[model samples]
Target chain A: MRICIMGGCGHFHTALKPDIELAGVCLTGEETPGFSFLINRFGKVPVFPSYEEMLKECMPDLVVIDGLFGHHADMAVCALERGIHVYCEKPMAINEEQYKRLKNAYKASNAQIAAMLTSRYEPCFYTLYKRVRERTIGNIKLINAQKSYIFGERPQFYAHPEQYGNTFMWVGIHSVDLILWLTNSSIVDSHYFPSGKNSFGFEGLDESAVAILKLQNGVLATVTVDFLRDEDADTHGDDRIRVVGDKGILEVKDERLYLFKDGEEQELELSDAPDIFLDFIENLDDKGKRLADDEAAFLSTEAVVNITGV
Target chain B: MRICIMGGCGHFHTALKPDIELAGVCLTGEETPGFSFLINRFGKVPVFPSYEEMLKECMPDLVVIDGLFGHHADMAVCALERGIHVYCEKPMAINEEQYKRLKNAYKASNAQIAAMLTSRYEPCFYTLYKRVRERTIGNIKLINAQKSYIFGERPQFYAHPEQYGNTFMWVGIHSVDLILWLTNSSIVDSHYFPSGKNSFGFEGLDESAVAILKLQNGVLATVTVDFLRDEDADTHGDDRIRVVGDKGILEVKDERLYLFKDGEEQELELSDAPDIFLDFIENLDDKGKRLADDEAAFLSTEAVVNITGV
Candidate 1:
């Protein structure tokens, strides 16, 4: 499958490009750090400084819009309108207004669009979701998750409101999406309070925020996002979820999933993030069980903004 | 220190009475399966059919109200009116109105009363609180806790609303009190929802309820309460908490405190639950930090009723 990569030299492209063959590039050099690396590997295959130029020249089957987070909706809209499938990273947009626009655009285009909430595609997350659905854990009462990373200096684009929007939109958006997909529930109500001052290049945005999400199924979840962790933290960052149910307790951390039911600890090895991503790629056109699509992406982003006012 | 035990004999009293040399008793033979065990040990101290009679007869220096969950405020008011100090078991009253009455009574009498929110008094819980205070955990943003047990048929008294108001009051109360005390902050706002189906016991009383608690200091906490486990589950009646902070994560489960900071898990042995009765007994002069007293107990109990309702 031929694919064009927007924001070609950025973090996602640097990691995902070698895994998936790329047909074209849209690197402005001003947007990302790894432009030289992309040029070295791909031999300058249709390099363009803008999305419109890339589309007109390459016209690839799929467009991977892994650019600055806040731009996903607009880029995805362009790709979908041109009858190309789109794989976009999360926080489809910063707020509900932008998310609604993306939703409408996706509907109007009637093309395949997926969000890279890859965590939902993981084996452990999917297993836990199935368990909750089957009532294997009984009635869930609470869900608590944390996604913390050590922030040093972010890319210049992250400092722009037009690019990253807010810390909640840029980083917190992952947890918001995963919780809903994992639980198969929608957030009924939510409240967020920003904590820890941010010294980043942005203004009026929190470096750390805590959101209380109340799911429609009566599950209450707390998601904490912090861009301030000590450097040299463990690989893959740190992610944890503690789900309390009437009959059991489930905790996932690192790559191990632990379920405490019948008063015993049962440990299982979880598939890593890459495995989850590969599954999505393989099942792209199955049409029976699609991965997280624009609608899921839109709702999750709307939930995040509703809670954090990004 | 002189003490009077009301509605004596349960696991709570059995564990505590020997620790705090019981000076008097006002048993009603209505408490628990352990009542006969207490009768075997204590050997007929004093018996009263009603709480009012017990208050009038055992006018001791300290009142240890270990009755049913719903009777706390009435018993507290009786002790306070007669200028007696109180250290009562949790869900200090059925509702906020009753808690207000007890608070006013204690204020008028100038008595030192403390709620037996013994989890706060537990050495592990206290250590966790102190660690957070000492910045060992840094700025806390997320707190998740659970307490569940294999539910059994309650005594006939439970069918009477006059005895046990709700399951959230009877058992879930502990989690509410602990979240407030451990965070050292008042709950600013909260949203609680029923778990779709009652797993613990009956209607009108939540067998299990989920609460998204917002602390005054911007910490987000989610707590769950349930009494629906298998009859033979080997769990320790359920206790766990995961506190995520800027620096690291601290988790406590089954008397083992695990600190995961700086990228490794450190196991620490925790001491047992505090001898609450001993603390209240030793502080009979209205001086020491009493449990379920006038001020603090009211807030804790109010939280319980707010989640469960009277």
Candidate 2:
């Protein structure tokens, strides 16, 4: 399958490049120096100066979007309207209106849509999902999802909250997707707390945020996201989820899954899961079960946008 | 000082009995079998039939209240009005009216008052507090406090939400006090998600709760409290507090303190801190600095009550 890459600037496409071959490329006109060289090291794909040129020239089966968050809706809508499947990076869009546009476009097309929600593909999370389904823990009553990322050097877009979306919508949507996917529930109510007090002098950027949500299954969940992790830590991100159920508690911390049941702690062996990019590619033909489909993507983005008011 | 133990039914005072001698006892008429024999093993203190009898007979200088949650305010007010110091168990009052009455009573008297907020006395938390004061994690931006208790056999009071406060106010107040005490900030806005879904067949008892709070210093904090822990776990309670600041993050878990700073993980050595009960006894005469004073107690309780809308 021919895959056209749009906005070859962010690392999302570069990370997925190993799993899928790129047929064409389009710049978002905001690429940094040497961005094309960084993305197309093999120099095998034709680099188009505009997305329209690339779409018409490549006529690719799938379009992977890694553009500016504010421009995602336009890119996604353009691709979906052409009946091309889309694999867009997270924050799917900057606001609800843009998300709605993407959703409407997907409804009108025969093509499938998915977002790069990597948490859904994590081995630890996959293990937790399996155990919860097996009732290792009884009915979940509470969930605490935490995501912390090191604020490494960033591009100019991060300085503008309006363009990049707030911290919760930008980074916290991963946890939102994980919670919904693992619990098989939808959000009933949510409250957000966003702060730019410790943005390290970055104006208009929220450095930290917390979202408390009530799920339809009567489970209370809180998602906390921040960019305050130490850059030299053992991991780039401290991702953890604690699920409290009637019978036991399950936790995924430090890339390991643990089940505290019957007053004893046991580490559950994590099983390997297919890569998200591979799953997306396989779904193109067989249309088998995908971790995050168009509906899941839309619902996660919508819940985050509504909670963070982004 | 002559300390009077009221409602000698629970183990809160019995656990502290080794730290101080009891002069008088007053039961709330809900004592379990051989309660007096268990508390007053030496049979040295006078077992009064009523609180009035104990107060008039013993004329104690300090009153330690472990009564029902519903009667805490009246007992506290009675002690405060007589110029007697009071050390009461947590959820100082079940609701705002009772808390306000206690606040007014404390203001109207010179007597000191403190609550058994044991989280403040934890050694690991003390270490985290000292490091945070030294700017180890820089300015605090976010805090995620968690408390999980094993719901073992309970008294009948827990079955009635009116007699005993709901889960958030009953248990989560410890995290609230810790947040305020460590950060030295007051709550600005708060929201609570309380669920009785997993009460394990107990009616009116909230098995889990989450509170999202915005502090006056622009810090976003969330506190999750639940009674769904495995009873046979290594610890009776799983208490943790993760503080994310501009520079790094500090966490207290498993009775140990960990600082993730400068891209490296370090286990902090916990320093011994004065016990809550001992501190209260020492502060009685000196009127010295106390970790949880009358105002701190009132503020913590007020913040919790307002947030939980109890």
Candidate 3:
């Protein structure tokens, strides 16, 4: 299982390097600096200057894309067209057109494509998902998903909406993915409210965004994302989801899953979460079920892009 | 002030009888049963057969309307027309036409009116409101207000949507009131989703509803109300409100207020909440500020009714 890395600036892809190594997947080549140092500081593997060169020389079985948001679709499409399994960072693409191109390329190949939607792999959320699927909360009627992050230092690309994507597409898509996944529903309608007043002078950037989504299953959901968390707060981000169902309510907040059912509140004991990178690699052999495959990525990315108008 | 009571079925007015009495207001006459029992449980006050009869004979300075939802507007209008201050149960009217008539009648009189929007008087909510007013959370960007209640026994009137208001207008209005009051904004645009699956066979009654409101202040808010709580639950209702601002987040859950600001979480010490009934009496004498006054009640009811299309 030879894997080549391209554009390793994204934190998600960078974080997956160690896990991929631990899974015994071979890192054939790299196209980004410092990534090679991370794989092997002794320089046993050659680091290529570009993805095309790496594909031509290394002929890796898999390609991991961790580039600017705007470039992900092109990179994924290229890899898929070459019959290489691709693990792309979320969102899978910047817009529906790019997503369509990638989807077309994937249809032409036998490789498996996955996106880094890690929320489903978190222990608390995984527990909540299982409870929901088991009908612990009965039929879900409404969902309120929130994502709040500290406005930390950003790369120059973030200042350009064309490269970084809008706040909802970049950050809110996680909640969108969760809504679709947990509810087993598709978006029927959506509206977006974006604000830039508190962007701290980041031009063309929305500091906060609220997306109201109506799902086909007759469920109403709202996803609110903001980069306004205090940098020194107890957590880097405040991620929470509340699911209201006919029988009861379920909420995941501060890394704990709480279920209110039958007039009693109880916290579920969550098992250790499966590693997304490892699971993606393992599913390559069996073609078995994966949490966030290409289809999930496409749906979430499309819905978010449509809502945010990005 | 001499006060008369009409249709004492609503628990709000029943609960306030003692407070009105302590405020030295005389109960000149009554129009409904059980109300006289609540006020004296004896034959201390004369019980009239109807509101008009009580009004004609007593000529009371104030009228407390604890009638069915459909009758609130007419009762308020009747008292207001006679220059009698009125305290009516919530959902001041079941529909827009009734609300409009009440508003017009209120405009044509000097009498002050109030509604049973008791959420603003809860100790925890009072603290949360004060903090928001103090800008403790910065400018409000998004609000998620939730009301979940146990599916308790209901009267026959609840089976008719024409009599009792829809779920959003009746239960979700408290959240709407809070949104308008806390954000200091009026709703500019709104949408509602109503479902009746869990209404316990109550025809034409919605057991759950979700309302998405866009406020004039550019704030986005969602209010979800459901009567699906377990009857034996620790609390009869699960009421929660989450306010997201640029600098921090404020949440009131389980009768406690939590603030997340500057990267830290803390529980706020709340002051004792003033009694709504007593405050209304005091404000009548002083012409001072009162929470959930006629204007607040009118705005909230109108917004909910408009959103629910009831």
Retained true contacts (fraction), each candidate: 0.27, 0.95, 0.48
Cα lDDT of model 2 by residue, A56-139, tens digit: 888898898888777777998999888888888887888888978888898899898888888878899988888999998988
Q: What TM-score does chain A of each model score against the native chain A?
A: 0.88, 0.93, 0.90
List TM-scores for all candidates, in order: 0.85, 0.95, 0.89
Model 3, docking class? acceptable
Q: Judged by DockQ cut-offs, is candidate 2 incorrect, acceptable, medium or high?
A: high
Query: Which candidate tops lDDT?
Result: 2
CA lDDT, every prediction? 0.68, 0.82, 0.78
Ranked by TM-score from best down, the candidates are: 2, 3, 1
Residue-wise lDDT of candidate 2 within B147-245, one digit each (tens)? 998887766777778777788988898899989987899998999889865366777888889989998988889999988888887777889999988
Worst 10 residues of 3 chain A by lDDT: A22-31
Highest DockQ model number: 2
lDDT of 3 by residue, A1-310 (tens): 6677767555434334533332212222322345555656423556566677677777777887877778888888888878888888888888778877888888889988888888989999988888899898889888888898887766666777878788888899889999999988898877777765436677778777776777888787777788877778877788999898878889888889998877678888996778787778877766557777668867887887787775
lDDT of 3 by residue, B1-310 (tens): 6677776546444334543431212322323344444566423676676778788788887787767778889889998999988887788998889999999999999999888888999999988999998889888888888898886866667777777778887788889999999988888877666764436888888777776787888788777788877777998788999898877889999999999877678999988988887778778855448876778878887887888786
Q: Which stretches in model 3 have alpha-carbon errors above 4 Å? A: A9-11, A14-50, A196-198, B9-11, B19-45, B196-198
Candidate achieving the largest TM-score: 2
How would you order the candidates by DockQ, starting with the best?
Answer: 2, 3, 1
